[model samples]
Target: MRAAPARRGRDGADTRARIEAVALELFAQKGVAGTSVRDIALGVGVSEGALYRHFPSKEKLSRELFLTRYATLAAEICAIDAAERELERKLRAVVGLACALFDAEPALFAYLLIHQHEHLGLVPEAPEANVVEAVAQMLRGAGVPPGRVTLASAMALGCVVQPAVFALYGRIKGPLAAQADDIAAAVMVVVEGQARG
Candidate 1:
């Protein structure tokens, strides 16, 4: 009956969610290239065939997971760019958000950070889904020279990202959010192009 179908749908959705969660954990622990569909299926407590009922292949699942999370972060960064007008304030907001996310969900954040290169080319071409473009757009709006925008954006993002990387490797102690203000200031230096020999 209809009730039986509804229950199956709920179970199917739960199974899919479990698959995604397990896949992300494995992907974080082992690089995407290192993780296998069997690994994900085993972790999720589902048969390999059942996993395929949700994702056709491991590559598709990895791409889907990467794009989904990356787009969410990109959208958030775009929203921050849209809301803040001042350059320093905008930098602080964006940096703070990145650090907070790293602290809140280290596995998800690490997955995104480490696997970005593998998946960036697959990202859809949309301003709201391109974090780099969003940061560049913010820099341009803040009066950073057109010629400098691209480099400045990379440098600015690095000011936040590198710390998270260091924290990930245990070289840095404590939550990244604690360093947000300093990171923001460092990003400002990049944006301003404060020359130092």
Candidate 2:
């Protein structure tokens, strides 16, 4: 007798979620520029057609993945902005939150960090809803000068996020969360320096 035909996605299975998970892993490991739709489909244990049913193209897949990851981080930034009132304290909270997120979802963190420059244009509403904009807006709202907002944001994010990349490469010794204080301190130095100008 012939075996049962293979199933498409089940009612609750949501192959789309699997597609995103596998795509994120491949993108995190190999970079979006290196990973293809075929690779993601293979990793998800689905045919290319199945994957395409979920995502029309590799570029669409990459942008959607980036959007999800960035949104998660953006939500955290929104919380930090709402909770903290001072620039220095808010920055410390941001770094601490970054470290926590890095520890919890390093791949997502790394994926966004790794691909932001290339995929920023691909993702819609990126500039207005991004981390830089969040930080800059926080600063602007706190009476910080417009010119200083950009520099302070750059300094804050770079200080916190660079070490996350280092940790990913094993260049850093401990979990990203463990370096929160150091990261926060370094960010404060930059923010303070920029504010003094």
Go through the candidates in order and give each one's C-alpha lDDT. Answer: 0.87, 0.78
User: Among these predicted structures, which one has the highest TM-score?
Assistant: 1
**Residue pairs with clashing backbones, model 1:** none
* CA deviation > 4 Å runs, candidate 1: 194-197
Give residue 83's error in model 1 in angstroms.
Answer: 1.7
Candidate 1 C-alpha lDDT tens digits along 1-197:
68999999999999998998899889999988899888998899999999999999999999999999888888998898888877788888999899999999898889999999998998876768888888887888888878777788888888888999999999999989988889988888888773221
lDDT of 2 by residue, 56-104 (tens): 8998888888876776667677778888778667877878788887888
Question: Using Cα atoms with residue i matched to residue i, what is each candidate's TM-score against the true structure?
Answer: 0.92, 0.85
Number of the predicted model whose lDDT against the real structure is largest: 1
Count the clashes in each prediction.
0, 0
